[model samples]
Target: MAKVFFTSDHHFGHKLIIDFESRPFADVAQMNESMIASWNTVVAPEDKVFHLGDFSFLNKEDTSSIVARLNGYKTLILGNHDRGRSRNWWLETGFHEVSEYPIIYKDFFFLSHEPMYMNKHMPYVNVHGHIHGQKYEGKNHFNICVEHWDYRPLSFEQIRDSVVVSEEG
Candidate 1:
């Protein structure tokens, strides 16, 4: 069986992306290259990767090229910014599929972008991207953006270890 990995919100080629939440990157192209390199370094050809949303900047051609370069079979969760030309680009790139909401994998909830309000009422853990890790401060529950990881198709066990979850009220 292939390993599975989950990540989100790369925003490649968007120079101002890092500035929005105070992420540190010199420029847009630099940021895009870094993300691609990092993802390739960690991902394997046969692995399955889940990209939550906002995978690239506005250019469809640029986005398609970047997607073609990345490793593994990708499934996309459509973010708010993912529409129009970007959507067409994703289709051309051979992504497994793209959806507006979460997909359940082994009981865990996977969303491309984080829900504005995560209802604690849900039984499974919500794994998503959109909000950078730094914004959360010390709070648990949200995992920050991961451009790449060595393991393909990471499991709930892998993700749970990295995230800090608060006790339910």
Candidate 2:
């Protein structure tokens, strides 16, 4: 059976992301290779991955190659930087689907490129990225940013358990 995973803010090919986000890697190539290796370790060819946003800062050639190297069927939740790029551009980069706004999954989890408000009354759990290393305040909100998850994609079970733990604590 295929599994579901979530991750974001890879910022591939962006050297500045290392300094801007305090990423441990020494350079962009290291960061890009590391993330790809880490992602493949957990994600299988049959699995599906939801990449929240900021997928890469690569040029068309780099973007195409990078996406092809990754494991799983990938879906992109368009980030701010993802704007100005055409739908075909994203599709050509190997995204199985590209969404323009937050989407409700299983009618329970809300997926977005940016952090969103979520509470018991809101009706859906918010799973998002784009805040990098910053913490969020909402109860049902979970950040799947690469900065938060050791640069690897998180399984659905991992995300759900996090929320359960947060609620209990």
Candidate 3:
């Protein structure tokens, strides 16, 4: 079966992110190539990938080129830096779907570009991105930033299992 994966903060073509996030890539080209390879390694063409945000810093043509070469049916949740493009523009660029705001999945995962206010009192798990190297503390908050997941998309089962393990330990 095709898997459902989540990831974000790719910041593709953003050279400054290399230094900002302390990414080990020697340069932007290497960073972009390595990330694309990593993504394709695990995500199949039929897989569904939900990218929380900060997908890219490149222009439409460049971004679309990158997205076309990637594997999976991609969806993007707009992030702070993603405001430059309209939802329709994003759809035309290659993303199968684009959401201007947060969305709920599986009736429990509050998917957003930025971490939402999730506490023990709430029954939802906030799966988010955009913080890069920083992360929130709590079993209810799951950061899918590429920095946290070895620059690869993580499957839904992996995220759920992690939450379960955290709850137990």
Candidate 4:
């Protein structure tokens, strides 16, 4: 069966990201290469990946190249930085699909580019990015930022089995 994975905030070609987020990489090139390798390591060409957004800061041609090199059938949920570009632009860049709002997956997880303020008491969980390396204090809210996930995409089971969720708020 094809697995579903989640990830966000790639910011490819954004050199300042390394210093801004204090990323372990020495430079942008290293960060990009490592992220690509990490992504391909777990995701097969046949799997599905939900890239929650802020895909890249590179030009269209460059962005397209990066997308082509990665594995999985990608679906994009647009982020703040992803705005202003037409929906067609994202599809043309290689995403199998694009979304402007949060999408509910498997009737449980709320997938969004930005973290939604969900309570632990709620039945649904919010899996999001945008807050790189930041952890919120509850089970219902999860952050899948590249900086937080070891620069790799996370499988659904990996998330579902994670201890990120707490038994109490």
Candidate 5:
């Protein structure tokens, strides 16, 4: 079986993304290229990757090109920024599926953006991205943004090791 990977909020080609958050790249193009490079390095052609949201900063044309350069079979969960683009734009880019809600896979639940209401009701692990990973520490939630770019799909085991379950129970 192929390995699975999850990541989100690349915001490729968006220069201001770095301004709002401290990231390693100085510009959007560089950020975009680096993410593509990193993804190719970690993900193989047979691997499945889940890109939660905000895949690109450019128009659909540019986004499609970048998607072609990356590795793996991609599934998208639409984010707030993805609304302006047409569904056809995403469909043609090699994405297997696209939606604004959650998807269940094995022992985990995937959301493109975070869901504020699913906390207590979810039985499996919840994997999501919108907030950079570094922003929260020791919490059950995992953020993919570490050292600047989002880390590609990690299993529930990988995430659980870094997360601390709440003591309220």
Candidate 6:
């Protein structure tokens, strides 16, 4: 059976991200290669992957090439940086689906490119990216940024298990 996965903020083909995010990769090529390998290592072609955002910073040609090499049926939730292209343009670039705003998943998880304002009083758990290594203080928020997950997409089970919801605020 196909499994579901979530990830964000690859910033592929963006050289300056290494310096800005203090990524260990020596260059953009290395970063891209490493991330692609990591992604394929765990995800099968039949698996479903929701990419929260910042999938790539390359031109359509280059982005399409990279996306073609990746495993899984990929969905993208647009990030602030991803606004450079239209939703249809992203579809043409290889994402199976694209969304300009956050969406609810499993009646509980809120998926988005950037962290949403979630609280203990709310019934939702926000699974998001964009803040990179930083994470919110409560179980109501989950950060799936590549920077926080060893450069690979995490499975939904992984996120669910790690996020221990408490009964009390």
Model 3: CA > 4 A from native? none
**Tens digit of lDDT per residue, candidate 6, span 1-169?**
9999999999999999998899999999999999999999989999999999998999999999999999999999999999888999899999999999998989878999988888668888899999997867777889999999889999988887777534242
* Model 5: number of backbone collisions: 3
lDDT of 4 by residue, 96-121 (tens): 89999999999778999888878657
The models' CA-based lDDT, in order, is 0.66, 0.89, 0.93, 0.89, 0.68, 0.91
lDDT of 6 at 6: 96
Best by TM-score: 3
Among all candidates shown, the one with the greatest lDDT: 3
Q: Which 10 successive residues of model 2 have the least lDDT summed?
A: 116-125
Which model, 1 or 6, shows the larger lDDT? 6
**Residues 1-169, candidate 5, lDDT per residue (tens digit)?**
6777777888777787777777778777777777788888878899888887777768767878998888888888876777677666787776777876677767555444663344545565456667763454333345654333453456444555544344233
The TM-scores of all predictions, comma-separated, are 0.78, 0.96, 0.97, 0.94, 0.81, 0.95
Clashes of each: 8, 0, 0, 0, 3, 0
Q: List the residue pairs that clash in candidate 3.
A: none
lDDT of 1 by residue, 8-113 (tens): 7777777777778555568777677777787777678888888887777746677778888898888898876675545556777667677766777776554447
Model 4, residue 69: distance off in Å is 0.5
Order of candidate numbers by TM-score, starting with the best: 3, 2, 6, 4, 5, 1
lDDT of 2: 0.89
Q: Judge candidate 4 at residue 44 and give its lDDT.
A: 96
Better of 1 and 3 by lDDT: 3
Q: What is the C-alpha RMSD of each candidate to the true structure, in Å?
A: 3.9, 1.1, 0.8, 1.8, 3.2, 1.7
Residues 47-143 of candidate 2: C-alpha lDDT, one tens digit per residue: 9999988888888899999999999999998998787787788998889999988888877689998888665689777898888999788777888
Worst 10 residues of 3 by lDDT: 116-125
Model 1 C-alpha lDDT versus the unseen true structure? 0.66
Give the TM-score comparing model 4 with the true structure, all chains together: 0.94
lDDT score of residue 27 within candidate 6:
92
Q: Supply the TM-score for candidate 1.
A: 0.78
